[model samples]
Target: MNLTPADTEVTGKPASRAKRPAKSAPGAATSAANAAPTTTPPVTSSPLATPTLTAGVASVTHLTEKLAEYMSPSDLKKVKEAYRFSDEMHLGQVRKSGEPYISHPIAVAEICSDWKLDAQAIMAALLHDVMEDQDVKKDELIERFGAPVAHLVDGLSKLEKIEFQSQIEAQAENFRKMLLAMASDVRVILIKLADRLHNMRTLDVMAPAKKRRIASETMEVYVPIAHRLGLNNIYRELQDLSFAHLYPLRYHVLAKAVKAARGNRREVVKKILEAVKNTLAMAEIDAEVYGREKTLYGIYKKMRSKHLTFSQVLDVYGFRVVVDSFPNCYVALGTLHSLYKPMPGKFKDYIAIRKLNGYQSLHTTLIGPYGTPVEFQIRTQEMHRTAESGVAAHWLYKTGDTNMSDLQQRTHSWLQSLLDIQQQTGDSAEFLEHVKVDLYPDSVYVFTPKSKIISLPRGATPIDFAYAIHTGIGDHTVSVTINGEAAQLRSELRNGDIVEIVTDPASRPSPSWLSFVRTGKARSAIRHHLRTINLPESIVLGRQLLTQALAAAHLEPDLPETLIERLLNESSAKSLDELYADIGIGKRMAALVARHIYGLMGGESAAMPVDHANAAELDPVTICGSEGVSVQLAQCCLPIPGDQIIGQLRRDQGLLVHTLDCTVAKRQKQKEPDRWIPVKWGSDINRRFDSRIKLLINNEKGILARVAAEIGESDANIVFVGMDEDAEHVLHQLRFTIQVKDRVHLAGLLRNVRRVAGVNRVLRERS
Candidate 1:
């Protein structure tokens, strides 16, 4: 579809038409074009021969007829004039479909016309490929037609001169370019979608590799774009076409099975249809019931994803019933359920809570004749139209320009979001990534404390919801309550859940939130916050490590920032902040650098009396005993808050502050002395920490549970419980990782476990 559109690769000059004079010549819309005399349209739009692919004239005349239905005489002539000009420009070229290349754009225009686009849009579709395929300039187009049409074509054309590393990169770059253009003018996307649709219709004529590449890109980008725009008609077509090209064998197999099913189920379907028709009439329900089959791609997806064959896909046959009013939908649903047994959990009332794309219907599956599952959708006529067309319905169902409808309003929100995401994510690749994440969300709709519906992508956590509500709420999200019960921030939301995000004024976004957040908004906010906030925190940690190392070398830790700068002047880094950042991010070692700086200061090679006045600067880290991500007790040492701790600054690995004199800490200190830093207990130690302990207990009935209960009595939670097998049957060593406040709490838990009937010995694990 794009290849014929000049996609910026084809150069050309103006093919003149009766319009504005050439303003910006070659390169301004600068491309080569075959200039022509200006005699654009006969002020009247006489109905031309309807354009059918198999029409009398397979030339532009065929396309002329298709436009005859919608366009006025004057508009039709203008379209024909643009077509003739484009034809002359692409005189000898042809598409991979082996048709005159001009035929492609004409077909694209026809598609746009079917969507009820304006004269300018149809004309833009006609000339879209001219700049890329032929030697046509933007100025020439502007001169021949109007600026609006030219702008639309320019937006559709691919930037061709820049070389991409691979076909995929070029495709991504092309999409990025096109998306920005579409964001400025919504019509650009409609035309581009038409262009892509036409291209896909003729894609089978291309090579296998090219076909798959185009089809895959279509699946990932265009299909989702159509869906996001609520262009369900186009979305389905693109999906089916892409499925055919991407997985031909699967599509063929599924198509054959569906065909066979239709033949086999004809009689049964007829009987059920009649029964439903009669039931509706008797109940005074006015409705139109029609039998429908799922698309090949839909069936194939179910097969692949759900691991089911064609036979097992129960709801392959479906029915859509359109009624008079919203209330009638429920009436019809009740009537259908009374007529047949409804399958449990197969009913979804989207009418009450519409899908994010604005689809609404009451869906129910029932056991039809022969035990086959028959799915039914009940909606009003307007809902039916909106359901099928999505955002496009508002435009397609109208003649002239209409007021902005609800569908358009939501779409505008999505469009503006692209610009917002682009601002937050500067890299084009990253921008694409963020956009893609939002594009294809399989949503889970939840509720607020006020019972307001909040729909988010499936697998999205409460943290994502907090961020979605507002950055302030997200920053201060201290706790969550799902249905009035306390839950963690990482809790995955289910449908119908009433989630409450409890905020504390002092709390901030944690680095750990990034691990479970599923939405682009939360991911971006957390990343932005981390990049800005972590630098200072890491710098402080680096300085602390440096100070402790300097103290260990019997040197004064009172050096000011300026003093440290002079000491590190010989290094490439210019300032203390730079050196601190380097040390914090693992680029340099604190102890080695500190010792080197001490040597440069020309310190005496002797010990000095120290009052340790700077003990306030080297302070202990405050941590809750709970597994709060960043802070952790070293498993080898099981250091409690009261223990004298030595911290190791493992870059990106977080800190594993260990108790002094622990065997593992001693080895790590010896191997990487620079990594060892000073640490102590903070006054406000809250939450529990897991400590491994060995409990030798006699193997007895329910003995393990008894020991666990005893540990639980000590207010300790069982983190892990495993038996050391291959020991005597009567006596066994149980290895447990139990959560406790500290060594003192563990001591209390050990006594409790030792009191259990089968207990022999309870000792803290050290090896």
Candidate 2:
């Protein structure tokens, strides 16, 4: 992983040519021919002398020594210059621990150097805190270092100058800024992660509340990000540190327990190790085996989630076998299995199907030494490197190997997705929400019809799958099939299922998809599409609602231009469409706005107060069941045509139509009577409506199929079906949400279902 001279070609002047001024004898004539040039500053202290420390903070001399191993002389010179400048900028600043603030940046840069990051990244790391803490400007850094370094420094800086409504909002906006920068250049997040790791390491000096807050934030955001980027070494350390700070007692208790377990199991571990080594030696396989210990957080999480005791967590101690080649990984796995009994359904081959983060290993569990389960992971040396370093291996190895390139590509793809989500999302809080949704580490690998592997979050539906394939496909997805059989779009996909999506140009996303989708891409795409179509539809609906309200006062539907202008001005609307949209979306009451418009027109009845008793005499608003988002059918009662329905004007949700007899609607009416509007079904209704029904049937073979067939024969499409068995009565209670044309269509479907053989009773379900 060390860099050669060719890899150290940084953008700057040659080291020898760019030299610092040397001290001369007092009043001596300067001669250009005799002048001495050097890249490093003249040493005031002897190299063998005791090191100088400020508040227990070491000097940058150590950093330069480490850089000398892989960095070119010129790049090394630039890094020392950066360190000196940063040290000067943070002169009197001190940390909470009373250490010189320069120590923090030095520690962060050392972490980056450990990763073999280029000289430019090292310089950026040293200066990352200056812009945020010292108010240093980016242009100054550009003049001092270069544009690339300056950009990285700027990316690390927070938006502290701007005031936000809340601290969470401020944090979210800052993260949003940093993420967008990371999408452009991956080094931003890499440096930022190093910075966060150092802070977490030294977080004990902070107040209790601040410690918990920072620890929780690190666990929620940075920890997942580290895991996503495949930084296993850093990821594990961060998890342990966060666990230690967030739950000090639990972390210490688990740590102690693990320590004791190690002593008690030492003999068993030794026996298994010898057996595996002897078996592999006989098989003539070359491998390096090492024991792996689980992190404290991992143990605590396992105990809490799976309800296991410390001893029940058998895989806490495991082994990793690093081989010389990919084929040897499986050879070692087989060799080890020969020495012990392999556990069924406890093996996973990640090499054939790599994780989304580009992690590859062959994992298995074996019964070792007195029936104890031991976990083993087999991988090649290169795979091991990639697993530990992840995308950072691209720079560390600099070999352009297939594995390294694939890891880089996968990371870039994920970062690019964040940018796409940012473009679709406008609010910082909402963008952060979407990012959190995407950050979940657990993923399931499924397949496209063409055998292409597509990885999605666990519990992700076909909607998420469609969007993962393409935004256009997701927008136009009409149906899908799982494993060559028709399946609901909301079905939870399983591993290895072949998902085939059917799209139509006329098909569009439904708002209900937001309830089941697990990916942010699908959610954002649906919202963007809905917003695009909502405005125009809302304007039209608002006009109809206002016109109906105006008719109650004996006014014309089309008002004079002067009166319209006055109404727009009085309503604080920039345009007539804005005014109507507000009314359509229920932001303003149509009746009050109509009365206000009447007064603008000098109508005598405009002075009359609104009469609630006469509300029934007004013209009714007509809904055709296809009024887009501006008009919606309430899901509580699932109102359809021929059902006596009333409209409830909900702010920002537009008009919700519900059955007049719905108990939920009655409760709402008692609280907010003025929000209720008289509505009627239009003659041109053409779409199907969902109605729920409950059925009790005799428990017998093929009874469910018989009832479903009866509903299908009546031309009703079943959207969802749920069943519960009554063992005491030997009957089954089945609930179905089916789509039909109207109340009449639903009645016919119910009648068919009731006539099916073995049917005990059928009734419409209302809330």
Candidate 3:
């Protein structure tokens, strides 16, 4: 398997660009230049300095020097110790590029140093691969570098053996574990990110399929995470590199497009930068101004998503202005607008309203020289540092060597938030799903009644906002008032909208909210509440299921606890507690549990019901049996009490009950006869069942309203309704999930459905 990096992209042309009047700011061309760092320490030539260091014996002296700019001697010593340990452990191993494996760790540490990470993070980076690739141990690491650094390194290690059913599942699980570990300590994530970046840089050595898989995962998982953490520099580079590997043709095309745009925008960029530089100088603002080009991935993403040609994708160029102070950032913004025509409605002040990751900047798009559109971001030196280094910048920017309580609080809040999400969500797939959604870069900023601004992911409705504000507000949300107007509680929020949530004591989370809510926290909280509320009922159902299963096996319901415990021990369960917990969580099949419990209680081949009166009735109305298949018709397909039916013995799956006339049954019988079983509807069955009906109504605005009314009149719940269309008809598939005592009740409901206006076909689905 291979792992690569991913990139990011800008979405749209400036909305206000369409309303701009052409204007050109006259100025000399600015030099094609890169900005210099505000403070630079002297560099020392390395022994292996062919430019970069050599393998195995390469000194981390440069990394140490860089660290010294950000850390103390004690911390520096700790980092050196870690580097030395990694070097010894990787003494003989080598990378595909023929560099010693120790060089890889040194390189990873160097990347982290570029982020200006704290001593612990850098130390962890230097030792990240030791446990994974060598015989070195975590205990050894702890002894050398202390518990925290060792713990961070251990957290960053990939599982040694992944016994997943498929490669995708294995990779996904590995990513899940990585994210979970990262949630506990942000440093683990930083080290992992550095590791991934280095791996991506070496991905060309891997095979093509592996390259694509790794690159896709990087795009889908890691890059979004980096973006969420405000590590946009890494985020963007990862995206670009991954795209280059995963879609080289597209990457080159987009790169050329951006390069060509840069060449064409040369005069515009030069004039814009000169005008801004001169304006800032006149305003006596000490600032650094640099031009920024959109990454190739950004251009490709815009072209692919918007179905636009390369030239049609605007906003491909921008500039970054870094000032010495927060006040000077606004001054620079003012200077920029004065020098160029400001595009109306194309300004955002992120400094006043910071992002979830604490990113702060003033963003604007202007009609620059030659009427070309350009985006500009203005920020202070500190904001620039944070923008590049993200959480790592906190270590360097603190004054007087003060404690990191405030920084720790903010970082810990973000970390603990992930753990909270994990606790509420049991399914790894669902947890990852929520994390992906939460990591989307598009954001919507809203305000509370007290005027405190909060940002949430775009498309986030008020329910998400409620949870973001406080869990109590989310759990008890009854209604909401958006900007003084009563609004539906699920209303989508907009930028700068003031929202007030209304709660009721009796209000509780609904499963339906999962369909509309967007944030991970809100989704997890709602699901957790629902899970808790349903647990007692589920446990009761489980008990009934267990008791009925025991009766089927000719065993007593209340067998001795000692016998059950002995049976569980014989099974794989370490103790009864594990068995019961599994049963409670639906992980252990109730039927299986009952069978094991009954077998331990003297069940025999001869069947008998200990309590004949309490034996569950084999109701013909609910339980359909065909050819010993014991096919209970799926309520979804609804083979009625008298309906002819067939059973599909699904592979590693439950028998699927279907009517004899069901097309699905016919297809399955044709393909796999040995898997098929006969089924019949039980005579005494009395449970309510659901079957779908279709209506071909003329496509009209209110056709859905009439059909819904008819279903309501029939006393049926509209469990689901889906609409498909053709030129000839608006095909509506309506699933009336209703209670039916028997075949007669179903027939009557079908007849009633047939009478509804525009109802075309009310036939039951074939088994």
Best by TM-score: 2
Q: For model 3, state the Cα shift of residue 33 in Å.
A: 36
lDDT of each: 0.70, 0.78, 0.66
Model 3 stretches astray by more than 4 angstroms: 1-59, 68-74, 161-177, 396-410, 505-507, 536-767
lDDT of 1 by residue, 208-287 (tens): 87678677877887888888776777887788888888888977777778878888888988998999999999999999
Worst 10 residues of 2 by lDDT: 1-10
What ordering of candidates by lDDT runs from best to worst? 2, 1, 3
Assess candidate 3 and give its lDDT.
0.66
Higher TM-score: candidate 1 or 2? 2
Candidate 2 regions exceeding 4 Å error are 1-55, 163-165, 395-404, 538-624, 641-689, 694-762
Task: Report the poorest 10 consecutive residues by lDDT, candidate 3.
Answer: 26-35
Tens digits of per-residue lDDT for model 2, 85-193: 7766665555666566567677778778877889889999989877765667889899999999998888777786776646666667878888888888788888888
